[model samples]
Target: MTLLPGVRSATVDTDRLRMHLLAAGPEDGEPLVLLHGNLSTGRFYEHLMPTLGERYRVLAPDMRGFGDTEPKALDATRGLGDWADDTAALLHALGIERAPHLVGWSTGGAAVAAYAKDHPVASLTFLDPVSPYGYGGVRADGTPVTPDVAGSGGGSANPEVVARLAAKDASDESPFSIRNVMRALYWSPTYRLPPEREDVLVAEVLKTLVGDDGYPGDHAPSPHWPGVAPGTRGILNALSPKYCRWADVVDLDPKPPVLWTHGSADLVVADASPLDFGVLGASGAVPGWPGEEAFPAQPMVAQIREVLDAYAAAGGRVTVEMFEGSGHGPHVDAAHRWTEVLLAFLVSA
Candidate 1:
């Protein structure tokens, strides 16, 4: 992948895993850690590294199952614990004595939140993070809809999409193709990255390790309506409400300042996200949906707001910014504004 002018890529061996990282700026600059979301790697943030590196030491790593990192098996039962611990190990190995500013996008949001719960951080920037209650099978109040947390986790992953990813299909031939999926879901529908940049991003996604130990992970047969449940391995299982939940950030002692930013048109983490089972069922995309009362669309945005509100009520400083007309990746679709707001927050924090 082509890194920005100032960015440099390297490998670091920690006790936990050998990690691939993109780093820039002076080694002694204020540390800034950027964590990427699912289906992506540290390369996803390359476009922003140079600008961010101007004043801080920017380190973005490929987490366990993605990019050039060693494909260590992810224990889904730990939720984001493995990633949090991995980050801690990475920082310790680098001798980062000072707490670093953390910026997480999508799934990375949960990872950083998990870290902040037990570790100190200068600040947190959540860019279109997952719901505090986890991804799916959740109600408005952050409770699971089914006893087994069915209709979520590994099974929720689209098989066609998973297969395409496994095949490393980079073409836009089908809607399920990885390239098409990125174009459709990663940013505003009208926004397009330059051809070369898009090529790099798509290649980065194709590097994801796919299987029970990776992307969607494994699944189990469920007695519930969806007929499937999360298995104890893989990325999606880690994201299941059964294992993933970060709402307890409200109770963190000496909480770090938080900046939450999202796109107004984000479909990936919406109250009725198109990928959500409830939304699919409600729209008759999935048969035998059990109706709205039993499986209403998960209120993802509302759940995040509720948790942040509670965090604020409990005396944590919090800021929220919404970018109109953008999609899931505001940093890509609204780079200038996102950068300005992020820098302003980091400066004041």
Candidate 2:
């Protein structure tokens, strides 16, 4: 809601749906699109736009089912293809014919990778991205442990957190409150966003759609150990390995330069993430884990490395930067350093 100076807001109409976006810099400058992750709006990149916009036309849009974008039904069956197609439509609508440099955070990282799988891009920067194989239900080798992909997707979301989000509980009265979750998981527990900025982010998260057509989407009963599988629709379902996978990006023709930046202390997308069923099962948090051999914690970061390494092996330029002690959000926790590295890479890319 709070726009830093020089940032402008706009509503652009694309064929698929109307999109709300934040943009800065000259219209004629090279285009640079920043995609935010799940549970966040384009506003999450507000602070970064000014710097990025100085040299490029920076645009950040609220993805479908999040922020002010029209709450269209997301087809999880298409995986991130819906989002990738949406970005293409938005770019075409904006009259941007040239492939633009892209930066994606968390879920947005997968979104950008999906975009690159079928489109040309000037460059790609992944910030603590989800695994190339998807979020959960996969082994270290990116293979699904169960046929139904149990313990992943919409049903895997904590009901208490979803309920709190639906209630718009901004107060930090409960551990699951939006504000508290943001503080605890959005960044390293040791770092804190300024009060005003934190308020803005919490407000943005509250605007997210919360049901089958949105955040956690819907779930179906599964015969597998965890007993739940991703339904055919919603954001989380789109992230399930059943439908989501971007490792194919490694095979793109005229492959673009890639920069993978991550925080060492990331908890949201870690091998031992508290949200992962395998981790929960290992910790005795989820009963009947079925033992490690049957289902081990997903090696999220390692999967990314393998995919990116394959990308490099296939002739794409790749760079990896790890920010020690930061949490899931390096852009928020290590803004200056992240910006510096990104700008340098963009110039070379």
Candidate 3:
């Protein structure tokens, strides 16, 4: 992958796992950690590292199973705690005594929240994060659709898509191909990544390990219509509602300021996300749907708003910024605006 000038890559062995990372700026500069989401690596942040590196020590690590990190199986039962603790361990190994400002994208947001619960951070910036409650099988009020958290986790992942990823299909012709999936799902249809950048992004995505200990992980059959529950291993199960929950951030003794930036056009984490099976089933995009009553579309954005509102009511500082005409990765789709708002928030925090 083509890294920007001054950007360097390395691998550090932490107590929990060996992590591959991209870093820039002075080591003595104020620490700023950038965390990527599922199926992505530290290379996803290559563009932003240099700009932010001018003032802060920018560090982006490939979380556990992605990129060059050790291929360790994740404990889905711990929710995001495994990732959170791994991040903390990395910081300690790096000798970062002071809390670093944190920036998380998508699943990375869940990791940062998990970290904030037990560790201190300078501030939090969530870029289209997952719902504070979890990914799917939950209502706006954070209630699960089923007792076993069915209709989510590894079973929710499309088998064909997972197969394509595992095969490392770089073809853009098929929708299930890794490159096409990134172009179609990662950004707004109106916005296109340049060929070179797209290549880099696709390469980073292909680096993701796909299996029970990796991408989709494992699942169990359920009596429910969607009929699948989280397994005890892998990234998808780690994000399942049965395990992942970070709403308790409202109860932190010293809550840090939070800056939440999301795209109005984000289909991955929207109120009726097209990527959500419940929504697709309700819309007849997927056959054999059991109807809306049996499995209503998950209100992911509303869940986040509710949790943040609770955090605000509890006397914590919270700010929400919605970027119109942008998709899930606003940091890339609307880079200028996102950087402006983020820089201002970082300064204020």
RMSD of each: 0.7, 0.8, 1.1
**Per-prediction TM-score:** 0.99, 0.99, 0.98
Give candidate 1's error at residue 327 in angstroms.
0.6
Q: For model 2, how does the per-residue alpha-carbon lDDT over 58-99 read when each residue is reduced to its tens digit?
A: 999999999999999889998877888889999999999988
Residue 2 local lDDT, model 1: 59
Note the Cα lDDT for every prediction shown.
0.92, 0.91, 0.88
Question: How many clashing pairs per prediction, in order?
Answer: 0, 0, 0
Query: C-alpha displacement of 19 in model 3, angstroms?
Result: 0.4
TM-score of 2: 0.99
Clash pairs (backbone) in predicted model 2: none
**Residue-by-residue lDDT tens digits, candidate 1, 126-147:** 9999999999898899888988
lDDT (10s digit) by residue, model 3, range 123-200: 998899988888888766778888988888999898889999999888887888988878777888899999988888
